[model samples]
Target: MKIDFEKIAEEHIEGFKGGEGRLDTRNYVDDRARIMYSTLRPGPKSGKHPHAGSFEVMYVVSGELTVHYDGSEEIIKMGQVHYCPNGHQHWFENKTDHDVIYFAVVPTLG
Candidate 1:
């Protein structure tokens, strides 16, 4: 099946998990997964939080992002992907001057 994000997704500004600044997100949710096309301005971050019942994968669509997980951090540039497994904590920070664009896929566990 195909999902058309532009036609069906809802956009919102949210400060998820205590992150700094607001995040612009176009999201699609279902019983199996939550898919998001997200953007963040430079210096803002998605706050750290544990994935208690889901695993999340983020694919960088533009600019750069730093993924922080389990006490370590990695820079994910355009075209890169980062994964946060269930039961672990993670966050994303945009350190560049440009807006960071990414797609996040979070699948339900069990």
Candidate 2:
């Protein structure tokens, strides 16, 4: 199946997932998973949290982000991907001058 993100309305969220600043995203959610195209602005971050019953995969489309995974810091650049397995903790931060655009999918565990 094909998903057209352009057809989805974008939402600007403040303190997304309890993080600072805002996140602009277009999301498609169902009982099984959530797929999204998001842009993380500079100086903002995704709140640190654990994936209790789901796993997340994020592919960077442009720019970069600093991912705090578990207890370490990883820099995910354009064309790179970051995966957070179930039961792991992670968060994303955009500390650069440009926006960090990415595609993410979170699949729920049965």
Candidate 3:
């Protein structure tokens, strides 16, 4: 199937943080995979959380973000990607001075 993405900016925007309040999401379920598009604002964070039943893979589409996982943290900037395995704790934040866009993939019902 083909998916048009022109209206994603207005349809799916949740889990916003400080600086600016916006969360854009485009969720698609394919077989058992759930694909999503998320946008974050500067000085905002996804906060610390854990993936209960899914492994989340994220691709940074624009700007920069700091990712914390397991017991360490790293900056996943623009053009970079990161993966958080299932049952692991992770979090992401836009500590930079610019906006950031990212795409995430997870399992259905996860």
Best by TM-score: 2
Query: For residues 1-110, what per-residue lDDT tens digits would candidate 1 score against the true structure?
Result: 78777886556566678888888888888999999988888888888899999999999999999989999989999999999988999988888899999999998878
Model 2, span 1-110: residue lDDT tens = 78899999999999888899999999999899999999998899989999999999999999989999999999999999999999999988998999999999999898
Mark the 10 consecutive residues where model 3 has the least summed lDDT.
12-21
TM values, all candidates: 0.92, 0.97, 0.77
Model 1, residue 3: C-alpha shift (Å): 1.5
Best prediction by lDDT: 2
Looking at model 2, residue 78 earns an lDDT score of: 95
Between prediction 2 and prediction 3, the one with superior TM-score is 2
List the global CA lDDT of all models. 0.88, 0.95, 0.75
Quality of model 1 by C-alpha lDDT: 0.88
Q: List the residue pairs that clash in candidate 1.
A: none
Question: 1-110 in candidate 3: lDDT tens per residue?
Answer: 66555544445445543223456667776778877776777766665778777788999999887888997988998889999887898877778888888888888552
Best first by TM-score, ranked: 2, 1, 3
Winner of 1 and 3 under lDDT = 1
Clashing pairs in 3: 12-24, 12-25, 13-23, 13-24, 14-23
Measured on C-alpha atoms, candidate 3 has an lDDT of: 0.75
